[model samples]
Target: MIDVEETYIENRVMVQPNHANNLQTAHGGHVLKWMDEVGAMSAMRFAGNSCVTARINQVDFERPIQVGDTSLIKSYVYRAGRTSVRVRLQVYRENLRNGKQQKATESYFVYVAIDDDREPTTVPELGVSSDRGERLRDEALAGEGQ
Candidate 1:
């Protein structure tokens, strides 16, 4: 079984000039990029092998994060198959100036572990071991309309 603790991952990035569009707000593409990166990290952590995106179900941008804000991406593997890991990611924006924070975007991504030859590889089964993990898994599954 997959180590539940190992399946959770987080990454943080600052919204720099390059990550913004002409509007000064965090660009949708950049947010999606970070979500994909963090989701992949969670998948790889759960699979213990390299993984590639099989699908990005959807990305919902709820709020705008301007420059100077820090984007924190949290991801966890909530389900797994023989070769696929389903990851849920949440992106939040921390505004240092006002000490405010909000969820900027969220997405669910599916990844398939691959071997060196680029063939699908098996991954360990996921285990829900803690209240937080179980809760997150429940949330993700519910978000998937399960």
Candidate 2:
């Protein structure tokens, strides 16, 4: 079994002009790319094999991260099946000066572990062994209804 915390991944990116849309905010596509990358990392960490994105659930962009702001992405494997892993990803817009953050977007991603031949392979079970892991799982579950 793999502890949920062991699969947790966090990443930060400064939204630059190239990543921004006409509104001077991070483009939705750019945010999605970051989320997918982080989610894949979490899934691979848990599966211990190369993982491929299978599906992406509803993605809601709550707010925009300005071009000069920071995008904080957090992802963790909350559930796993025989050959699939479920990752919860949340993006936040952070103000560097004030050190404040607000939810920018969130989505659930499903990844399938693959072998050298690119065939699906079984993955270990997911366990919430620590307080942080349990809390993260609970939060992900709570958001499922929305």
Query: Best candidate, lDDT-wise?
Result: 2
Q: Weakest 10 consecutive residues, lDDT, candidate 2? A: 137-146
List the candidates' TM-scores in order: 0.94, 0.97
Candidate 1 per-residue lDDT, tens place, 1-146, comes to 77566778887888999999899988998888888888888898888899999999867788888898999898999889899999988889987777677998887889999999999999988998778878888898999752
Extract clashing residue pairs from model 2: none
| Cα RMSD (angstroms) for every candidate in the order listed | 1.4, 0.8
| Residue 109 local lDDT, model 1 | 89
lDDT computed for candidate 2: 0.95
Error of 2 at 52 (Å): 0.6
Candidate 1, which ten residues in sequence have the lowest lDDT sum? 1-10
